[model samples]
Target: MVKPKDPSENPTTTTNNNKMFIGIVWNCVPELKLLLSALLFFCSLITLFQFFPSHLSFSIQDLRQCSPFPPPSSPPPLQIQHPQLQTDNNNNNNIIQQNGVIKRNFNTYGSAAYNFILMSAYRGGLNTFAVIGLSSKPLHVFGKPTYLCEWVPDSTGNGSGSVTVSGTKILPDWGYGRVYTVVVINCTFPSPVGIDGSHGGRLVLHASTSGGGDANFNLTDTIDVLEEKNGLLNSASNELAEFNKPPKYDYLYCGSPLYGNLSPQRVREWIAYHVKMFGERSHFVIYDAGGVHSEVMEVLRPWVERGYVTVQDIREQERFDGYYHNQFLVVNDCLHRYRFMTKWMFFFDVDEFIFVPKKSTIKSVMDSLEEFTQFTIEQRTISNKLCYLDDHPGKIYRKWGIEKLVYRDMMKGIRRDRKYAIQPRNVFATGVHMSENTIGKTTHKTEGKIMYYHYHGTISERREPCRQFVNTTEMKVGGKPYVVDTTMREAAGAVKRFELRMIGSALLKTRQ
Candidate 1:
């Protein structure tokens, strides 16, 4: 220190002197400390933005490019809606409320609203164009419905026109309080609407009506115009050509909707016997309203595979409130659907057996009565429970229901309902028992020509049909007079062998 020390040799002393100088400066200016801290924080923020640019910066365009959010894992349950307002004569409005929302009563109004089974175009004679369908009854209290026919264009670009037609609504007296009915619309075009066999088109139905209050709506239906290959035009010749020939089937059976628990054995016998009776030129169309279960299907599958039968599953029709399985709706639909496919159409039930007397075939019976457009067949009621006393309880009971149960109801003067056959080409509308709106004469005097044996309530019986085996001398069963009638029982053996040959022996095997 005395000789003036060099800075390098006295480093600790110099460092301490510098610290002392900084301390003195910091103490004198407090602003210098604040300024340094602010500068340090600013530099740190700049470093953060430089390292993580995407995290700090986001744009609306990026959000728009992203995928949508996923839906919920499970859907909400359905809610059944009921009408809130009551309808009456004084109150005309048919308003319904659901979940605090107001809606028009489509079901009760029955104007433009209806459930349709089928819609098809019909050639009324040679020039008349018509549209027909089976629909739910439209109550006249609301108003008369107006119909408009719109012809859709075909592949040939021939049609695409509209015309207002006169709608003919026929609610047959046989509805039995059911809702379904028949609607036929006749279209009168201003010009020639070229619809024919080769050139096919479509028909659109536009319906509307006025109800009370602000209740006004429009309904529409579209259906394909069926081709009539054998239809004769006003200027056509050569009836022997392929397009001018007759339909494939001569006789067609339109069965009412089969429902409830049906015995497989009875069904098997019915199909086989009818197939044999109707011959090769006939076909059967069966509608299942919930009856053609797996067992019944097994009985019918063979004939269906052989092209003699067609089974339509109409079980969903039960949800709607209609006549006994909607039978009237079903028959009318079948009538128009197979109208041109067969010359004669039959309406009856599964339990009823159609029988022509010996020496006369079904074809002969029909040909003899060909002059009549419609003929009512006399129905002979057979006892479902009573059987012949001579029939072996074990052997005859093992046979088909129709084979063993041969007792006929002999109640005199009882007006039993009758089933009928129609030349489908001449019938406008049909019913379950018979048709009233036909073009030609209808005869109920079909005593010997044709008749059906109605085994009443036997089709649904699951238990043994021989509830009480009565002797041939017995006059009545359950107080109703009956007599031994062996008509169907005599033919039972032939029917059994025919069934075994057609469907195999599996169906005839004795049940455990």
Candidate 2:
């Protein structure tokens, strides 16, 4: 470092004394500049290579063994179903094979299981619906298209269209223990939704497709295929399971008066069916319209002669008309006549019926109920809005009258279609509305033990000209004339035509 550079060797200044600023052109400066340029060029190459790695396969030439990238994990399994669906058309009702009728029990599966069910399957092409919860009643349903046709057979055979999916869906109740119910929903495709496939027809549910249209059932939602009706009668069944259930009911009861067009044949069979249930103790109480005619009594004599019922002819003594209070009259008279035996009296129109608990017999159950209940009243309010029927007064059929008169003033409020529905609307009664009235006495019996089946009274005596006893029904609004009479010339003329039907039978019976 101490060695003094020769003036020519050091490229910065020339050694020409006063002329040092004017240096000679030398290879030394050229060589020095060339070295600096070479160093800068190498640095730029390194940076350029780092920035453009894609263009440069840059073998570090130093690092040769780097691991190849790990192979990708296998694709996850496709979620095939919400849960699995197993079906069987053997045993009884066509059963969907069940593995999870209920979700796993909590205490058994853990503890805290609430009452609920899971409706998983909607309308996926092939995926079955899964339900995961407790069912309050035994109504456990899942949406699956059932053939709803002939029974399917097994490899071994010996079965019908019955059997729920095997396995258990744990349904835990708050107080009750866990229960498992297998629902083998029966669905027949090409179902007719509206009546007879007519115009403006809607999605009418078929008995085959909609769980027998049972009653009071919960469905998932629209896009949903599950349909169930609530509170179905232990009605007709083809299966043996329902048939084998112990008979707890004693008998069924019915009371009516015959009218034109409604053949006594149907009534006769209806009574016989009821009597079959109770046998020897069967009773039929009937009162026919003797007003303006005594012919009905003579015609129904065979039914009375059988001693299965007692017949009363109110018209025999007086030229009476079926007044406004005729319906109430029947109840009062019957209750008074059978007051001693009638611990509980159910008062309803001819179209109305009393539905009792399945577990108890009619006589025993009714007797066991507290004796103090004087009267139980059931009522339903109908709406002006029509349901099921699009055309209000069309040819399809009429229930109460020829046409339902909608009062624009009264439409906003609740009104009774008294003649047809005890109520005016579908939503009003909440499905066959009813009341239980114990005439001024402590009803110690179970509160909801009894139910009323109040069908709109448009059949039998009320609709036909031959059965109408009262000719007039009078009503005055604001002291204005508002009287409707069935005895007018038009009505009387119609009655005259229908009476001819009975006259032939009447003459024959009298001669016999």
What is the C-alpha local distance difference test score of each model?
0.71, 0.31
Per-model TM against the reference? 0.70, 0.27
Off by over 4 Å in 1: 1-138, 154-164, 173-182, 186-192, 196-200, 212-243, 510-512
Indicate the residue-level lDDT of 483 in model 1.
81
Model 2 alpha-carbon drift over 4 Å, by segment: 1-266, 273-279, 291-303, 316-322, 325-331, 340-346, 375-448, 461-512
Q: Residues 308-419, candidate 1: write the lDDT tens digits.
A: 9999998877766567876776787788778778899999999899999998989899998999999989999988787777856668767777767888888988899899
Residues 1-512, model 2: lDDT tens digits: 69877777665554454354335435368877998897666555544444344534444221222312232345755674544434343322222345534433212133221123222211101112222212323233332212222212232322232222222222222122223221212222232221111111111111122231233332322222232222121223322232245322222122333333342322332333333324454455665543213443444454456555576654331222222313223332333233333223233344333434456555654565434433233333211222223243353233222122111121224433321111110100001112222123433234355533322433343232122221224433344332332111122233333434323333232210
Query: For model 2, how big is the CA root-mean-square deviation?
Result: 26.2
Model 2: worst 10 consecutive residues (lDDT sum): 423-432
User: Total clashing residue pairs per candidate?
Assistant: 0, 54
- For candidate 1, what is the lDDT? 0.71
